[model samples]
Structure formats: structure tokens, C-alpha cells
Target: MKVNIVGAGVAGLSLAWQLVQQGVEVEMFERGTRVGEKACSWFAGGMLAPWCEAENAEPVVLEYGKESLAWWQNALGEGFVDAKGTLVFAQQRDKKELKRFARRTQAYEVVGHDVISSLEPDLASQYQEALFFKDEAHLDPRKALIRLTEVVQALGVKINFEQEIEPEDLLPEKVVDCRGYNAAKTVQSLRPVKGEMLLVKTNEISLSRPVRLLHPRIPLYVVPRDDQHFMIGATMIENGHGHQFSVRSMLELLGSAYALHSSFAEAEIIEMGVDLRPAFIDNLPRVERDNNIWRINGLYRHGYLLAPYMAKLAADSIFSDTHEIEKLADFKIKEDRV
Candidate 1:
């Protein structure tokens, strides 16, 4: 059966790849000229730390996110998913905040000043206590998106850029909408939560993995990219303002980076970005099959962490013709055999 997928974001691209791999012809449409710009995944820190996310996310996040590490490795190959783990720390005043975070999460080892020095030598002087989640990983979202797109295209899936497709425009065996926040018109439960991030470059300090600096307010996460670049983000505002970055947010994010290491104060600010993430009422992803269109969305902050598994589920339902897809909206949806 031929499939029509709208939106070339991580969810859409991942789903297209899954369908095509099962010998189904896939055609994808994106309103943007390229795959990376329009989607919220572009601004993501790409941290796959399910244990850390469990502090605020539901149990399902950890359940599916644990699978994403291997899934992404298979999709994008080695060097794509960085397994350097995640280091979470706090300032002297925010020690309680760190302890509170540790109590809520799992798969982490409490590290003192000496251990922190051994793990990330640059951070040891600043933080006396930290929690190290050794199994956590991260990726460069842009690179992953591009690599996945290349693989899907090589598999003979057709992706048309600058094409905004509507349900009525396609006559395919199945139509899947992975438009993220743009699907709000069709999915009433979808809401856009604005997230802001900063990209900075510095050569003075080196870090191999993602780091979360805990605070009572304005917590920050920094994910190290190739070379001297690092991505710092933590803000999640309710309103869907996508025009520009807020001054207050900029100050806080940069301040958190400085708090991580004094060298960040001199790091060059390469870019500031803001994007709206699609989320459902429960802040969990759902696959609702209505008539011929299947809407997969509400990824929230777990796009990279959950899209692969969601894609597998969508593909299984499409091929089996037994599952309604909508009935699988429950958080307890089992892992797809694929």
C-alpha cells in the first residue's frame, strides 16, 4: 500500500522510513524548503536521558525512550547517538535542588567532587556534588535529521519540499499526519509550547556529554556538539510566541552556562532560536486513526527520544489492518515487534 506522510520532521521522516522499509511506497510533503527548519527538532538539545526526563515526564517516556538509543543507532549508524552519558549538577546554593532531582530520577550514581573531577574534569571545581546517569546519551539533531532524510531518499521514498498537503489532496491507501504543532487544525487536543535555546562556541572548556544544571528556577541543560560548539536550553513557556528569543530567557540560559563553567561567559553566541513544540493534554504522544488519516503527534520534548518507536507502531498498524491506531493511544502501548 502506498502511504502519504505530511511534515518532514523527525516524526514524519522516521515514519516514512519505517513504512518504506516494509515495502510500502511512501510520499512525504513538507511546507518548508528543507526538512530541518520548520520542525521543532531543529532547536532540540537532542538529549536522550529518559531517567532525567522521568522527573517531569510520564512513565511511558522512560519505557519508550530506553528503546530509542538502539533505534537511533540502527537508523543513523555509529557516532550519531553519543553515549557519553549525562551529568547533572547544581550550584552551592541549589544543592537541595540537585538532591530533589536525584530523588525523582533513577539509573544515576551520586558523585562527589573527586568523582565529578574524574568524570568531567572541567566541571569538578564548580560543582561539589552531581548525579551521573551513565546510560543516557545525546545526538546532534540536525545531523540526525539530515542523515535520516538521506537514508529514506536512498530507499526510494519521495519527499517533496515546499509542498503543503491537505487530507483532500492525497488519494493514498493511508495518510499519516506528523505535522507536529501545525496539525492543531485537525487535532483539537494539540497545543504549541514555546521552547527557546542558545548555541554557543567556546574552546577554553571541553565536555563530552550533556549536562543539566539544576536550580529552583530556570534549570539549564547543555549538550556538547562536535568541535567547540554547545547547545544550552531549558525554557518551556506555555504561550506560542515564535517570533524571537526573550531577553530574560537569554540572560538566564547564558547565566546557567556561566554557572556550569566560567569559560562559557566568554563563549561566542552563535545563534538564538525559538520553536513551538506540539503537545497533547497529557503531554504524551498519541496515534489516532480517524477515517483514512492517522495523526501522530504530541511528541512534546521527546521527539528524538520517541519518534522511532512511534514510527514502528504506525507501520505495524498500517500493515496489519487490525489495530485502529487510535485504540493504541493509551500510554501502555507495547513495543512493536519490528
Candidate 2:
């Protein structure tokens, strides 16, 4: 069957790859110059730490997204990603919050200042304690997206560049829309959570995996990339689509960076960006079928962390009814699997 996908984001591209691998013909249409760029997954921290996410995410997020980091690394290969684990820290004042976080999550060990210092010399003595989720992992989202694009294109999938596709253009064969906020115009009540981010360059601090700093007012995360650069984010504003980072937001980000490690004070700010994460009030992704069109949206912040799992289920969605993936079904699902 020939399937035409409307968006080239992770959901669309990944679904395309999975379908074509199943001996189906696929074509992707992108309104932008390329794929993945339209979605926040492109700039994502790509951390698959369900434990860390448990700090704020719903219970289902941890249970479902836990299989993501390793699944993608194994399928996409090691060169396209990294599974180095994540370290979550906080100031002494936020120690109570950290304890609460640990109490709610699993698969982590407490790290004291000494062990934390040993792991991140640049962050030595910076934080009193941190929670280390060893089973969790992170990757370079930009590189991973590019690699996924290249691989899918090489697999006989045709991509039309800068082509705008309307709903009437969709066909009856398994079409999943992954257009992110663009779908907002189609799905009513869809809200955009504005996330502002900053990139700074400073080899003064090097981190192998993603790190999160718990703050009372604003929570922040720092994702290190190649060439001593780090993608720091973000201020979660409830309304608006302004791409420019506000003065106050930037100051808060930089201050958090400094609080995490003193070396970041000397880092040069490279880039600032803002985008809306399409979401419902619940913040969990929803897959809806309109006629033959399967619309997947509301990824919120889990686009990178959940896209692989989403794609796999999307594939199954095309061929069969999904297994719901609830934790209560775990035992029956596993037992019935073999």
C-alpha cells in the first residue's frame, strides 16, 4: 500500500520508516524545508529518564516511556544516540523536594557530594546531593532526527520538500499526522505551552548526560552537546507563540546555569529559541482517528522521549488494535507475548 504522510516530524518520519520496513510504500510531505524541524523533538534534550520525569509527569508517563531510550538506541544504533544516564540535582533548600521526588520514583540511587563530584568534576562541590537514575539515558536530538531522515529516505521513502498538504490531500491508507502545533488549527481546545530555551558555549563545564536542577519557582534542565555546548531550557509559559526569549526568562536561565555550576558564568550565549509544545490539559499524547487519518498530538514535553514508542504503537495501530499499555496489563501482556 502507498501511504502519504502530511508532516515530517518524528511521529511522521518514524511511522514512515516503520511502514516502509514492512514492505509498504511511503511518501512524506513537509511544509518546511525539512523534517523534524517543525517539532520540538528537534531541539529536545532526548532524556529517557522516566524516574526524573516522575517529578511532575503522570504515572503513565513513567510506566510507558521507560522503554523509550534503550529501544531507540538499539533500533537506531549507538552512533545516532547516547544512553549515558541522567543526573538530577537541587540546592540545599530544595532538598525536601528532592526527597519527595525520590519517594515517588524508582530505579535511582542517591548520590552525595563526593560521588557527585567524582562524576562531574566541573560540578564539584556545587550541589550537596543528587538523584542518579542509572537506567535512564539521553541523546542528541538534532543528530538523531537527521540520521532518522537519512535512513528513511534511503529506504525508498520519497520526501517532497517545502510542500504544504491539506486535510483533503490525505488518503485512506494508514495516515498519521505528526504536525505538532500546526495541528492546533485543526484540533480545537489544543493549547500551546511556550517553552523558551538558550544555548551557551563553555567547555569550562562538561557533562556526559542530561542534568536537571530543581528550583522552587522555575525548574530547569541542561543538556550537553558536542563541542562543549549545552542546550539549556526552559520557561514554561502557558500562553503565546513568541519566539523571542524574554529578558526575565533569560536571566532566570543564566542564573540557574550559574547555580548549577559556577563555570557557566563565563559561557557565551549562542542561541535563544521559543516554541509551543502542543498539548491538552492532561499533557499526555492522544491519537485520534478522523476517517482514515490517524492524528497523533499532545506530546507535550515527551516528544523525543516517547516518539519511538509512539511510532511502534502507531505501526501496531495501523495493523491491529493497541494494547492500551496500562501497568495493570503488564503481566498479562508479557505472559501472552511469549
For model 2, the local distance difference test gives: 0.77
Q: Which stretches of candidate 2 lie over 4 Å from their true place?
A: 172-174, 321-338
At residue 84, candidate 1 shows an lDDT of 80
Q: Please give, for residues 5-106, the per-residue lDDT of candidate 1 as tens digits.
A: 989998999998888878999989999999787888899999998999999987778988999999899888877898988999888888899889988899
Q: Best-fitting candidate, measured by lDDT?
A: 1
Which residue pairs come into collision in candidate 1? none
Instruction: Kindly provide the TM-score of model 2 when superposed on the true structure, using C-alpha atoms.
Output: 0.91
Model 2 agreement with the true structure over 1-338: per-residue lDDT tens digits? 77778888777777787787788888888888876656676766667778788777776678778877666776577676666678888888788878877888888889887878777766765776888888887777778778878888888989988888775567656566878888888888689898888889996878888888988788889988899999998788886686777889988999998888888999998988778888887787776666567776788888876666667666666666453422322433565676
Clashing pairs in 2: none
**Local distance difference test values of all predictions, in order:** 0.87, 0.77
